[model samples]
Target: MNAPLLEVQQVSRSFGDVRALDGVSLTIAENEFFALLGPSGCGKTTLLRSIAGFEHPDGGAVLLGGSDLLALPPNKRPVNLMFQSYALFPHLSVAANIGYGLKREKLPKAEIAQRVDEVLETVGLTAMAKRRPAQLSGGQRQRVALARAIVKRPRLLLLDEPLSALDRKVRAEMQLELKRLQHEVGITFVVVTHDQEEAMSMADRIAVLAGGRVQQVATPLELYRNPANLFVADFIGTSNLLPGPSAGQHLVVRPEDVRLVAPGAGRLDGTVADTQFQGGTSTVAVDVPGQAKPFLVTEHGATEAVRGTPVGLAWQHEVAVGEGLA
Candidate 1:
């Protein structure tokens, strides 16, 4: 196999007393859309900053194209970071904002203008070039920031919470845009996000982080289907984690995998605590006798089960599907 485009080798960092990145290490392939996913305070942002040269790790090294990346400063490194806020200059026009980095690089006036126009067209904002950041919509502002980052044509682009500022609808739209932009430009993207759905929807592969360590690194489906441990199983999506036959292990059954049946028909029986209608799917929370948390069962369209209804839950046997990843 070919070498990775970016390699993070046992990178470690810490705050005054708290360890932020505990020997974290991962790799990214060329032109891959990769995500660092975890909850707040999980060291994902710290790791991204470290890779961008904004933060230095006490130990270990970061390599870009097999060259030492830590030896350079943020500006000197061949990378650009897009802030969560989109960080567009309010006073500058969209065109100026996109070309700001090029100006600093002392590129010729004509070349900067040409490159800025090319990027504006690439991001589909050619018509809004004259508008200021404040005049643009949230999505437009995000595009300007993206255009600015890519205008420099860096080897790797780091985006910190790129779409967190957009509303649900706009965010959904921009997710596809980001993927399209990445593929069109063929630039390696490393995005940091706490949103699981965002990471799952966009990234080719994700590195799930927790308490400064990598839990598992795999494609979204692989991570969902074969979680490395209880944390990964519970974090990626919903998992009905009941005790397995062996001690200290769990039978990780997904809600979609669960089949609802009459009380006497299933391997386990439960009382329907509640049913939540979510557009095309209904999430039925079932309270089983031995389990502390309700077993969530996903039913397509509308569910027939109501509160207080007794139901049985059965899923495909482990042998029929595949053994849970540990």
Candidate 2:
């Protein structure tokens, strides 16, 4: 493989005595949609800001396109950051705001206008170029901010929870728009978000971070199916973390992976404890005879199980165990 477009080597950051990032390192390929996913205060945003030149790392170097980025100022680096709030100038029109970066470079009026028009078209904001930020809806304002960032044609774009402020429907719509925009522009996009659903839906590869360290980096499906550790298994989706011995390590299995069989058909026997119906699927909690807590089982098209019903549970060995890598 060719050298990565962005290389973060042993990056570490601290605030007095507290460590925000601890010896974090990762590489990002050109034109890839990468996501830094973690819970709040896990240092995902700190890592993004470090890459964007907003926060200076005390320990390691950030390299972009084979060049050290530490020596360059934020404005000189080939990166643009789109903040969560959209950060649009309230007084400026959409077109003027999109053209702000180009104008600051001392480019000629014709060139700035030309580039602004092109980006407006790219982001589907040409029709509302004259409208101020307040005149547009949430989605339109987000597009304008995106156009402004991309107008400079930076080599990399950093997004910090860009869709978190929007409603669920709009957020889903913007996810597709962001993906389409990335393909059309063909630039590297690194988004930092705590929402697992957002990362799973949009990222080509996701780096799961926890407690200021990276836990696992893999495609969404791979991370969901084959997690490297217990944190990843529980974080990526809903899973039943059973304290059963396997290969000298504790095991965890997703609710869907635990299959309910006829009585005396499986190794574990349980009594149904509770049930929750969620549209097409239902979840049933079973109290295993030897276990202290109830285990959850997710079944589709079968919601008839009631509390106190005897049942057998079994799961495949592969889904029950994950290699212990924390």
Q: Assess every candidate by TM-score.
A: 0.97, 0.92
Q: What is the C-alpha RMSD of each candidate to the true structure, in Å?
A: 1.6, 2.2
Q: Write the per-residue lDDT of candidate 1 for residues 118-179, one digit (tens) a residue.
A: 99999999999999988988999999999999999999999999999899999999999999
lDDT of 2 by residue, 1-326 (tens): 33489999999999998899999999999999999999998999999989888999999989998899988999899999999999899999999999998999999999999999998999998999999999999999999999999999999999999998889999999999999999999889999999999999999999999988999999999898888888898899887665545554546777888888877897578899999998889999998866767888999976888898999988887776464433
Error of 2 at 316 (Å): 2.3
**lDDT of candidate model 2 versus the reference:** 0.89
Task: Supply the TM-score for candidate 1.
Answer: 0.97
Which residue pairs collide in model 2, if any? Answer: none
Show where candidate 2 strays beyond 4 Å.
Answer: 1-3, 244-248, 289-294, 321-326
After superposing candidate 1, which stretches have Cα over 4 Å from the reference?
1-3, 319-326
lDDT of 2 at 278: 88
